[model samples]
Target: MSSRESILPTEADFADFRKQCLSSDNWANKYDKHGRQVWVEVHPGKKKNQVPKVHKIKCKMVIDDVPAATMYDVLHDSIFRKTWDSAMNESFDIAKLSNNADVGYYSWRCPPPIKNRDVVTLRSWQVKDDEYIIINFSVKHPKHPPNKLNVRAISLLTGYYIKPTGANSCVFIYLSQADPMGSLPKWVINKASQVLAPRVMSRVHSAGRSYSEWKQQNNPEYKPWLYPEQSKLPMMNPAELSIQKADELEQVDETFKVDAQECEDSS
Candidate 1:
């Protein structure tokens, strides 16, 4: 029921996410739509490492009909993700590191002229009191190498926090500071927080509304995320994954099509 002591995403990581979620200090409000709001903050890259400037994004909404637990399930269900995540090109669990942690792969479609992107991440989840936290960061996996099909992106920190508000209502917050590895236009970066973030949030909200019905007919009792004992995934050694660095990946400018084959090859 318990995992090995200490992991890549320590409790401090979760605490920092929670803190940021609750505060709006430096985050600039981008837009607000039907109670769902988005904010963006640009942080300069460190001088020594030459890290790329990070765009910290926050999107939050309140749903009166969907429970927090159901939202948690909606986010974790890869099978269900196929039905809801329209932009997703590929996604799957690679290996399990613990009952509450794992490494996974995800690739998504980007708008025309922009090359598609993918990432391998060390993901972990936890349930504490009335809140549920799911967080992940980019990690290099030896067994799964980035192919030419998609530029390897880096998720410095990305995750969700869900908290119950009422019997059937909850607050859902998403926070991300990821670098889509490639030379991208300023407009593209602006669109991410302005247009893309809200669209993704809307999709998730809709997914939560209908997830309960879909789960009942499917494997209703199977929830590896909540009940890790039910996971059939093979155990993986934590030593195999290292924190992914942006400098290591090839920086291809996405303004021009990297490969036409990537679009055709996508399933």
Candidate 2:
């Protein structure tokens, strides 16, 4: 069957996300990572409009010898996330909104001294000809709420545009705007947010290149939510998660041991 025939998003849904995926604005501060061009721009807020800081990021890179479908798989597949995204703590669909839309939960591992942040998002994805677009925004759901351990961060907008460049490669574009809902000033937050996206985008390119091989070993049978014809899969189990607090605890111990060794050697 054809890929367009195999995916499930509606024409209206595809149109909406495609618009956002391709929407362009003047972006500044361009740099390079992993042989890909990366840049970030902060939209200055006007208090009269009630807008806080908005961080706009863009990254472009070509993954050699990987089909666009495989890159799409890397971006949308939840089961194979842990293989490339080291910061992702947990992620899964909360409910199927439609054949092509769903609510998702994602939690990330933050460095020490700052608690982890999580978000609930509504996602829509579709493949048109050789181009694929997946876009999402933060939302609130009753079943999932702010927990004691992790703070909830609002994702104003997050999107991806994947277009085939050749028989074996594609260009990946990522855009993100988020509000952590903290006491930090808008300028302070925007600057801090700028540092995160480039790192995330760099990791994404590395992951996209390895996706095909990773999926083959991890869970080749797993079908994505975009593929409605496939059988339904359950949400990830809390116990089934590969990265847990135990792993964080081990890292803490390792740091402590290193500190003790440093003192002993110095004395």
Scored by lDDT, the top model is 1
* Per-residue lDDT over 1-267 for candidate 2, one digit per residue giving the tens place of the 0 to 100 score: 023432234577567656654555545656666656656654555454654345655656656667777778878777777676777778877766655667778887655445566777777777778888887766556567668666666665677888988888777777666655433344555655555555666676677777777768876777755567673744332222211111122111112111111110000
Per-residue lDDT over 1-267 for candidate 1, one digit per residue giving the tens place of the 0 to 100 score = 026444467778788889998897777888888989998864445463463456678889988989999999999999999998887898999999988899999998876777788989999998998899998888889988889988898888888999999989999999888777678753455455456676678889999999999999999999999888999999998877788888888879655634322231111
For candidate 1, which ten residues in a row score worst on lDDT? 258-267
* Model 2: residue 201 alpha-carbon error in angstroms: 2.1
Error of 1 at 265 (Å): 18
Which TM-score value belongs to model 2?
0.73
Computed on alpha carbons, the lDDT of every model, listed in order, comes to 0.81, 0.60
Backbone clash total for model 2 is 0
